[model samples]
Target: MDEALERDCVIAGGGPAGMVLGLILARAGLRVTVLEKHEDFLRDFRGDTVHPSTLTLLGELGLRERFLALPVTALSTLDGVIEGQRITLVDFGALPSPDDFLVMVPQWDFLNFLAREARRLPTFELRMGTEATGLLHEDEDRQPLEEKAWDVDAAVRGLRATSPSGVLEIRATLTVAADGRDSGLRRAAGLIPEESGVPIDVLWFSLPKPPDPTPPTLGHLSSAGMVLTIDRGDSCQSGLIIKKGEFTQMRRAGLDAFHARLTQAAPVLGPVVGTLTEWRQVKLLTVQMNRLPHWYRPGFIAIGDAAHAMSPMFGVGVNFAIQDAVALANAIVPDLRRGAAPVRTLARVQSRRERPVKVMQRIQGRGHRVIARSTTGRRVLPRPMVALIRLASPALRRVAAHVIGQGLFPEHVHTGSVTPRGGHGEVGGVPETWSKTRLWHNEGN
Candidate 1:
C-alpha cells in the first residue's frame, strides 16, 4: 500500500461546491485537498448563469473586480412571451445597486478563476485528473455510550482515490462528497438521495444572433413548447424543452421538425435556426430534483449536488451549490481549528442547507408541471389570468426578482484568511501525466 497522506479536509469533486468549500476551509488555516477527475474545466453546455447572490459573495471574498474584468454579459430583466404578447417576469433592477443584474460567463472560466484564487492560499491543494474511488472508515471510538454517541457503527475517516502517484490514500479529519449528483463517495457511504420527479428535459444548442437588437426577453412560451434564450454577443445559447424520455422521438422526427418547433416557440430565432442542422450540435440535459433525508454520517458529510440535485429552473444550481459550501465552512471551521473531528457539528451543515434546497426543488417541480401542461394548450396563461398578471406586474416582478436574485437563506463568508500569500505554501501540485489504473486496499482508514 502507498504511504498515507494526512490533511484537515479532503473534498471529492472540484466543481463549484467542492472548490468553494476547499477555498473557505483553507483560508481558515486548514489543509485542504480537492480532487477533480477532469484534467480541466473546459466542458461546454454547463451552467454559466451567476445569480446576484453569488456576485455579492465575490465582493465579500475581495474578488468581484477581478472576476468582472473577464468578458461577461449582464442581464437586468427577465421577460417572457406568451401566445404573442410580451410580459416582463422579473426586473432585477429594483434590487440594490452593482449586483442587481445577472452575470453570464462560461462555466469553465468561472471554475478556473476559483481554482486560481484557492491555490494562492497556503493550505490549499487542487489535484487535477484525480478521481475518488471509495470511502475510508474506522470502527466507532471506544468510549462510554453517552460520550461517543454516533449514528453509525463505523465513522468515515477519509477516502481512497487514484492520483498520478498511483493509488493514494487520504486521511482527513473531515471527508466531503462534492463529486456531484452521482457521487461515488456518497454511495460508498451508503447514502441514497430520494428522487423528486422531473417531467421535462432540455436540448441545448446555439444559434446566430439576429441582425437587429432584440428585447431582453429570456423565455418564450407557446402551445408548441418552451424555449429559453441567452444573448451571448454574436450567438444565442438556446434551450428547447421537451417531455422527458422523448429525445429518441425527437431524433426520429428529423431536424426539420425540430427547427419548426424552435421557431414556433420563439419566432425571433427563425433566421438562425437553420444553423442547428446537425444533431451533434445539440446536447441533452436530463433534469433531476432530489435530496437526502440525512446528509451526514459520523466523520463525513455530503454537500452540493451530491446531497441534492437541483433542476435547471432559474439557473440557480451553481449558486445553491456555492451557498452549501459557505454554510458548511461557517458551521465547522471553529471545530477544525481546535483539532476536533467535528462529527457532532456535521449535522449543523445539513440542517442549515436542507430547507433551502427542499424549497427550491419544490418550486422547480411546480415550474416543470406548468411547462408540461402549457405544451398541450399553446399558451401558458389564459386571457383572464393574463389581465390579472398584467395589472399586478409591478409587484410581481419585484418579488420574482428577489427570489431568483437573492435565493433563500443566502450565506456570507464567515471564515477569515489565516496565511498571507507566499508565507508558507505548497500551492499547486506538479501536473501529472499518468494513465488510468485501478488499485484497491483492503485495509480501512
Candidate 2:
C-alpha cells in the first residue's frame, strides 16, 4: 500500500448515510474519515426530496437555519392528477407546526452542505476521489480481545481503497458501507440483500421550466403511466414510472411513442415534450426494494441503501437513508467510546432499524402492485373507489401525511455535538429567492 492510515471510524460512500454518520460521530469527539469516490457532489437526477423527518433532524443538529438558507422549494402537499382529476395524496400542511412542508433541493446541494459542515470538525476527515474497493480483514492471530470474546473469526479492520495518489489501506475500528444499493464494500464483506423484486423502474429527465410561476404538480397518474415532476427553477426534474423492463420496449417503439406516453401522463408537459429530442438526455433508475438480512458483521456494518434499498414510491428513499445514519450513530457512539463496537452493539443498530425499514418496504410494494394493475388496464381505481377517496380525503390526507413525512419510528440526533452551531430553528418561511444556494463554506465569514 502506498499509504496507510488509522482512525476510530472509516466510512465508505459519502452519501446521506455516510456523511451524516461521520458528522455525528466526529461531533461526539471520535476520529472519523469518510471516503467518497466522486470528486464533487454535482451529479444530477439523485433523490432530491428532503422530507419533514430530515428537516426536523437538521433542526436538532443546529443546522436547520443554515440548511433553510439554501434556495429550496417547499411543497405542502403530495398531489397526483389521476385520470385528469387532481387529488391530494398526502397533506403535509396538516402536520405539526413549523415542519409542515417538504423541502425540495438538488441532492448535490444537500450532500455538499453536509460535507462542508462535517469538515469543520477537527476529528473528521473527508477524502474526496477515494474509492473503497474491498474490505480489510485481520487474521485470527492478530484479532483484538473484543473480537476474540465476541467469537468473530475474521473481524473487518477497515477498507482497501484506491485514490489519485495510489493504493491506500485504512485501518479503522469500525467500517461502514453507505454506498447505496450497489454497495461494493458490503459485497466484499460477503453480505447479500434479499431482493423483494420491484415491479417498476423510473426514467428521469428534465423539461424546460413552464412560464407559469406556480410549481409543477408533485405527481400525475394515468393508465399510461405515472410522471413525478419538481420545478427546479431553470428546468423541471421529472420522472416517468414504467413497468420493470418496459424501457427497452419503449425505446424500440421510438421517441414519438415515448413522447405520447409523457403527454398522456402529464398533459402540462406537452409543450416542453419537444425539448427532449435525444435518448441520451434521459436517465434510467432501476428501482429495487431489498434489505440485508443482516446489517453488520463484527466491525463492519451496512446502512442506508446499502442495508435497505427503498422504493421511490413516495420519494422516501433519501429520508430513510438519513434516518439509518442517525439511528446508527445513536446506537454505536457509546460503544465507540469504550473501543471498537462489539457485534452485539452493532446488532442493536439493525435491530432498531429493521422493523421500520421492512414496514416501509411493504408499503412501497403495495403501491407498486397498484401501479402495475393500473398500467395494465386493470381498473385498479373504480369510480366508487375514487368517490370514496374524495370523501375520506380529509382523514386519509392526515394519515398519509404522518406516515410519509415523519416515517415509522423516526430518529432524533441524540449523539451529542462538540460545536454549538445553530440550534434547531423553526421551519416556517420560504426564501423569496431560490437561485442563490452555494456551498456552505463559500459564504462570507
Candidate 3:
C-alpha cells in the first residue's frame, strides 16, 4: 500500500466542475489532487452543448480554439414550435460576441480535455477509479492529526481495480465536494439543498440521425407538454419534459410504447424515431434543480452539481457546472496562496456564488411551470395570451442568453477580472455582454 498523499487542496469528483477547478488551482501553483470514481470518460447521452458563456470562459483560459476544433456543431439560432409551426425565437447573430451560439461537443471529450490539461500542470494530479468515502476532521492540536487531519480518505483502485491497493488519505488545507448531486462529501458534511419547489424531470434519448429534418437547431414542441429536440450532429436527440419520477414507468411500458408516445408528442420527431433499432440505443436520465442553504462547512465546501443541481430545461447544466468551478477557483486561489483561514475563504466563495445560483433556480422554476402546465391551460389560453408570450420572445431570448450565454456562474468567470474594492469583491459584475438590448431589441446596439 502506498503512503498517504497530502495536498493543499483535495477535489472530489472529476466531472467538469472538479476538473476545471483542478486546472485553475494547479495553474496557480497549488498542490491539487482530483479524485474521480469513474475509471474512464466513456458515458453516452450526457450533456453536449457548451453555451456561449462557457465558450467565453474557455477563451479566458486560452482554450477556445482547441475546444472549437473538436467534433461539434455550432447552433446559430434558437427555434421553438408553437401551434405546430417553427419560429426563430432568438438569433445568435444578435448576441454581440463572435462566439454567439452554443457549441455541441460530447461531455467526455470536454472532461478529457480538462483532465489532459490538468495532467500537464505539475501541481495537479488526477486519480481515477477512486471513491471518496468520508471526510477527516482536524483534531484540537492545531495540526492535522496523522489520521484526523488527513480527514478525506479515498479508495484508490488500479486500472483493473479488483482489491483496493490501500486507503489513500488526502490531507489538505481544504476539501471541495465537486463529487456531483449524490455527493458523499456533502452527506458527510450534513449539508442539503433548500429545494426550490421546481419538480420537473427529463428523459433524454439519442437515436440515429433523423432521415428528414425540418428547422434543425435547438427546438421545442409545445402541445400538452413541451418536448425539446436538439441536433446531435450525426444523430437527432430529444428530451421529454415530464414530472419527477415519470421515466421508470415509461421505460417499463417497453420501447415500442415509449417510441410511440415520443412520436405522438412531436410528430416532427417521427423521422428521428424511425432510426432506432434497439432498446439499448435509448438512454433515460432525470434532472432536478436544488441549492444548498450554505455551500461551506468549516474545512470543506461544495460546488457544481454538488452545490446546485439545476434542471436541464435550458441545457445549461454542464455550463453551470463549469462556471461554478471558475467561481470557486477565483474565490479560493488567492486565499490558498496567502494561506488564509479555510472557513473564511469558503464562506466568501459561498456568498459570491449563491445569488446568481438562486436567480438561475428561479428562472428554471418558471420554465418548468410553463412546460408542465395543464392541457386545458395551454389550449384555452386566449390569442392575446399567445401574442403576449410571442411579444416577450426577446425577453425570453435575453434570459436564454444570460442562462446559456454567460453560464450559470457569475460574470467574473469570463471577464478574468474581479470586482473592485468595497463593492463585494467576492461577487462578480453583472454580465454586460448579455445586454438588455440584445435580449429585447434582437439587435446588437
Candidate 4:
C-alpha cells in the first residue's frame, strides 16, 4: 500500500501496555496511534493491584506523584492464609523504595488516566471504538538465505464505526500487539503460546461498602477458596476464588445462593454481601497464564497480555503490563531514532525481556499450584501434603515475600548500563557479539 498512509508505530488494544507505550513514544516525538475496540474507559473488576516495581517505573517517568494522587488504596503488605491462620507475606517496607506497597486502583480509572495522559502528547492519537481488522505487509528486497532477509512491511488497519469516516489504514514502521489475552492480532499472525498449567479461576463481585466494624484490608480465607476483601473503607467488596466453569452454576443458583457462599467463606464479609441488591452486580472472570513462543515476528511485536497472560491470583497483570511497556519503550526508542532494522529492534526487546518473563512465569505457576492445592486439590491430594503446607506457613510467607515484594518480574534491575567489549571473537565458547551483554544474577533485593 501507500507508504504515506503509514505511521511510526501503531498499537492495538488500549490497556495499560498500549497506553503507556503510546505516551513513551509520543514523548520521544515519534508518531504513534492506539486503536481500542472499547468505546469508553469504563470497565469492571479487572486487575487492580500495581506492584512496587511498576511504581518505580512510574517514578522514572516522572509520574509517581501524579499516579499516587489518584484515588487508590495503599496496601502495605500482602497476607496469605493456610489452614485458617493468616500469615503476612512480603512486607512492602522491606523493598528499597518509598512506594513499597501495592497500589490498588480501579482498572477503569487507571486506564482512563493513561488515555487522558496519552491524549496530551501531540504525536499520540487514540482511536476508540475502532478495531484492527487485518494486517497489511510490504515485501522487502530479498538477500541470501543465510543473511536473514525478512519481510519489512506490515501495518495494522483499523476500521472506525463512527460516521464521517472511512477505513483508517495506519501503517507503522512497527506494530505492537497489546490487544490482550485473546489477542486478535496474535491469532491473525498465527502465533501460539506455551501454556503453563496454573489451574485457578476467580469469581469476582463487589458489594456495598461493609460497615466500619468489618476488616479494613484483604485476606485469603482458608475455609472458602481464596478470598480478597477490598475494603474501600466506606463500602467494601470481596472476591472469591472458584473452580473454572463454576460461575455458570453459581449464577443459575441465583443471587441469594452466591451471597451465602461468600458469607460462609468469611463471616466478616456478611455486611457486604447482605447489601447486594441485584444478581447482575456480581462478575466472574477466568484467569489463565501463558507466554507466546516469540514476542515478535517480522515487523510486528506483542506486549502485555498479547505476549503473556498470567493468573490474577497475585494481581500482577497490570503491573507486569506496565513494566512491559517501559521495557519496550526503552528498547525501541534508540532503534526508532537510529532508524535501525525492525527485526533487530524487536529481537533486542524479546531478548531483554526473556529473563524477567521466565522468572514471573515460574512465580505465578508456583502461586497457582499453592492456592489450587489448598482449595480444590485438597480432596485429591494425600492428607500429609495438606498437612505439610499448613505446617510450613512461615516458609510459604517467605516464598510469597520473595515473589511479591522483590517483584515476580524484576525488569527494573536489568536496566543498567552495558560494558563495552573488544573485537568480535569467540569468548568462553560463545560468539563475541552474544557475549557482549552480561546477565546479572542478583537474587533477593
Candidate 5:
C-alpha cells in the first residue's frame, strides 16, 4: 500500500463534470485530484456535441480559439427527412454569437482538450488508470458499503481508489462523484436516481460522412426506425432509436434486416450503410432519464451523470454536465479554499440546477414516448402538422434552437486563469503523480 495523499477535493471520474470542476476549483487555489478509471478518453458512443452554453464558457476562459483550432464540423441547421422530403427542424444560425451552431468533434478529442487545459492549473492532478472503489467517512463514522440509507449518507472524508500503485487512500475536505450513471461512489454513498419514465434505447455506429466539409445534421424517420446522423468530418456518428429493450429482437431479426431498415429510412445515407459490416461495429446505448432525489450527503456531492442520467434525445447530456460543474465550482470554491465542506452549501448547488434538468428530462421523456408510438409513419409529426410547422418553420426553428443551443439555465465560467504562454500547456507547479514504480504526492502549501 502506498502512503495516503490529501487534497482539498478528490473527484471520482474524469468526465466533463469532474474535469471541469477540477479546472475551476484548482484555479481558485484548491488542491484537487481527478481519478479516471480509463487510461485514455478513447471511449466510443459518447455525447460529442458542444452546445452554445459550453462555447460561451470556453470563450470566457479565453481558450475558445485554442480549442476550436482542433478539427470539427459545425452544424448550423438541424433537419428531418421523411419520404425524401426535407424539413427544417432546428436552425441554429439565429442563435447567439460564438456558439450558434453545434460543433461535432470526436468525444476523445473533446475530453483531451479539457484534460490538457486542466493540466495547466498547478493545483489540478489528473490520474488516469485509477478508479474509486469505496467511500470514507471522518474517522470510523463510515458506514458499510452494502448498507442502503435513503435519507442519510456518511459525511465522506475521502475515498479509496485502486491504482497501479495498489490501494491508496485519498483524504479531502470534500469528495465529488462524477463517475456516470453506474457510479461506484454514488452507490457507496447510497444515492439513487429517481426514474423519469423515459422509454428508448439507441444503436450507435459510425458511417461515412458526406464529402462536404460541414454536413447538415439530419434526422430521418421511417416505418422501421428513426435514425440520426451527426457529421464528424470523415465519418458520421449515427444512432438508431428503438423501443426500450428491443435490441434482443432486433438482433434476432438479423443484421440484413437492420441494414435494409437503414437504407429504407434514408436512401441519401444508403451508400454508407455498407461500411457498418459486422455486429462488432454496432454498440447499444441503454437510454436512461433519471435524477437523484438528493444530490448530496454531508461532506460529498454528486454531479453530472452521477446525479442524473439523461436521455440522448437532444445531445445535451454533456452540456448539462458541464453546467453542473460550473455551478458547483462557483458555489463551493470559497469553502474548499477555506478548508471546509458544508452540507448546506452543497445542497444549494443541486437546488439551483435541478429545475432546468427536470424540465429537459420531462421534454425528452415525453418526446421519446411520442416517437415510440409512431411506427407506420416516416416522420415524428403528423403529415398535416409537419406541413403546418413548415409554413412557420423559420420562426419555430429559432425557438427550439435556443433551448438546445443555450440550455434553460446556462452556466458561465467563474474562475479559471489562462495558462502562462511560455510553458507548453503545463502549469508551473508539479502535481501528485501516483504510480506503482514511484509514488509521487505534491500539494500546494
Candidate 6:
C-alpha cells in the first residue's frame, strides 16, 4: 500500500454536501480532503436546482456576486398543466428576493464554482479519480497504525481507497460520507437508509429548448404519465416519471408508445417528441425517500444523500445537501481544536437535520401516491385535493414555495476564515489551468 496521507477530516464523495463542508472547514483553517471517484463534475440527469436557501448561504460566503454572474435562469414560479388546466403550483413572486426565485444552473458549474473557491484555501485538498473501497476503524480489526493520534478506540478512523496510482490510506480525525443514494462510504460504514415506500421512478432525457420562449420550468401531469421540463437555455432537461419497476414495461412498449404517452400528457412537446430518435438519450433514476436511523458512529458521520436520500420533489435536493454542509459546519466549528471531533459531536448534526428531512420526506411520500394513481387512468384530480387547493389558493402557493425553496430549517454560514495551520497567509497561489485537467492534481505511484 502507498504511504498513508493524513488530514483533519477526510470526506468521501464530492457532491454538494461534501464540497460545501470541505470549503467551510478549510476556510476555518482545518485540513480537509475530499475524494471523488469521478475525475470531473460533469454528469447528466443529476439534480441542478439551486434553491433560495443555498443561494443565501453562497451570499453569506461573499461569493454570490461571482456565482450569480454565471449563466443561470431564475424561475419565479412553478407552473404545471394538470389535465390541460394550468395551475401555478408555487409562486416565488410572493417571497422576498435574491431568495425569492429558484435558480437553475448546470450542476457542474455550481460544483466547479464551489471547488474553485475551496481551492483558494491552503487547507483544502480535493483528489479526483479516487474511490474509497472500505472504511477503517480503531476497533479490533484496525489497519497498522502508523499515526499515533488514531490509536484510541473509535467507530471510524479513516478510509482505505484506490486511485490512479494504487491502493492507499487516508487517515482523518473525522470521516464524512457525503456520497449519494448509492453511497459507497455509507455501505462501507454499514449504514443504510430506511425506505419510505415511494412508488415512482424517473426517466430523464433532454430535448431542445423551444424556440418560442416557454415557462422556465414546466410540469405536466396526465393520467398515463407525467413529465417535467427544465429550461436550460440551449436545451430543456426533461424527466418522465413512471411507476416503480416499470421501465421494462416502458421499453417493451417501444419508444413510440412511450413518446405517445408522454406527448399526450403535454401536447406542447408534440413537435419535439419526434426528435428523440433513439432510446440511448434516455436514462433512469430509481426514486427513493429515506433517512438513516443513526447518522454517525464515533469518528464518522454521513451527510446529504448519504444520510437522507430524497425524491426529486421540486428538485430541492441540492438545496438540502448544501444545507446539511452548512449545519455540520456550524455544529463542528468549535471542535476544530481537537485533532478529531468527539464521537458524541455527530449527534448534533443528526439532531439538527433529522426533523427537516422527515418533514420533507412525508410530503414527497404523499406526492408519490397522488402521481402514481394519476398515471394509471384518465388524468383527474381527486375532488378533495381540488377543494383543498382552491380553498388554500394564494396561501397554498406561498406555503409551497417557502417549504420547497427555503426548506423547514435553512442553514446560514457562521464560521469565519482562520489562519492556515502552516502560517500561510491568505491562502492563494495555485496554478491557473482552466481545462478539465485543472480539476485534479494527479499524484503518481
lDDT per residue as tens, model 6, 233-308: 7888999888789999888889899879877876777778877878888999998888999888778889999899
- In the range 223-340, model 4's lDDT, one tens digit per residue, is 4556777755455556777776777777789878877777666666776676766766767677778898788877688899999897776677787787788778777765664544
Model 5, 274: alpha-carbon shift in Å? 1.9
What TM-score does each of the candidates earn?
Answer: 0.90, 0.90, 0.82, 0.80, 0.91, 0.90
- Candidate 2 C-alpha lDDT tens digits along 1-445: 5998888889999998899998888777777889999999999999899999999988877788899899898888877676667778889998897889999999999999998887776577888999998777776353333333433367888888899999888888899999989998887777889999888899999998765534458877767678888877678999988888988888999899999988877778888888989999989999899999999998999999999999888889999999999988888877776676799988888999998999999999998987776567556577787778878888998999899999999998776555413423222222112232112221221
Which parts of model 4 have CA positions greater than 4 angstroms off?
Answer: 1-4, 139-164, 212-215, 373-402, 406-409, 412-445
Q: Candidates 1 and 4: which is better by lDDT?
A: 1
Q: Rate the local accuracy (lDDT) of all candidates.
A: 0.82, 0.82, 0.68, 0.66, 0.79, 0.79
Candidates 3 and 5 compared: the better one by lDDT is: 5
Rank the candidate models, highest TM-score first. Answer: 5, 2, 1, 6, 3, 4
Candidate 6 C-alpha error for residue 180, in Å: 1.0
Backbone collision tally, model 3: 2
- State the local distance difference test value for candidate 1: 0.82
List the candidate 6 regions with Cα displacement exceeding 4 Å: 139-153, 211-213, 383-391, 419-445
Clashes of each: 1, 2, 2, 4, 0, 0
lDDT of model 5 at residue 433? Answer: 24
Write out the backbone clash pairs for model 1: 223-378
lDDT of 5 by residue, 94-199 (tens): 8877678888888889889988876766667899999998877766444554563434644788888899879878989999999999999998888778887656
- What does the lDDT come to for candidate 6? 0.79
Candidate 3 local lDDT, 256-317, one digit each (tens): 87667777667777766766666666565666678898887766788988999877766777
Pick by lDDT: 1 or 5, better one: 1
Question: What is the model-wide C-alpha lDDT for candidate 4?
Answer: 0.66
Give Cα distance to truth, residue 74, candidate 3, Å: 0.9
Q: Is candidate 3 or candidate 4 better by lDDT?
A: 3
The runs of at least 3 residues in candidate 5 whose Cα sits more than 4 Å from the true structure, single-residue gaps closed, are 141-153, 210-215, 374-379, 416-445
Kindly list the per-residue Cα lDDT of model 1 for residues 1-445, writing each as its tens digit: 4657888889999999999999878776687889999999998888888999998888877678888888888889888886667888889898898889898888899999999888777678898999998767675342322333334767777778887778777888899999999998887777889998888888999888876647866878768689999877667888998889889998999999999988888888888898887999999999888899888887789999999999988899999999999999888877776656666698888888888888888889988988886556556667888778777899999998899899898998866654435444322221211232111112211
Ranking by lDDT: 2, 1, 5, 6, 3, 4
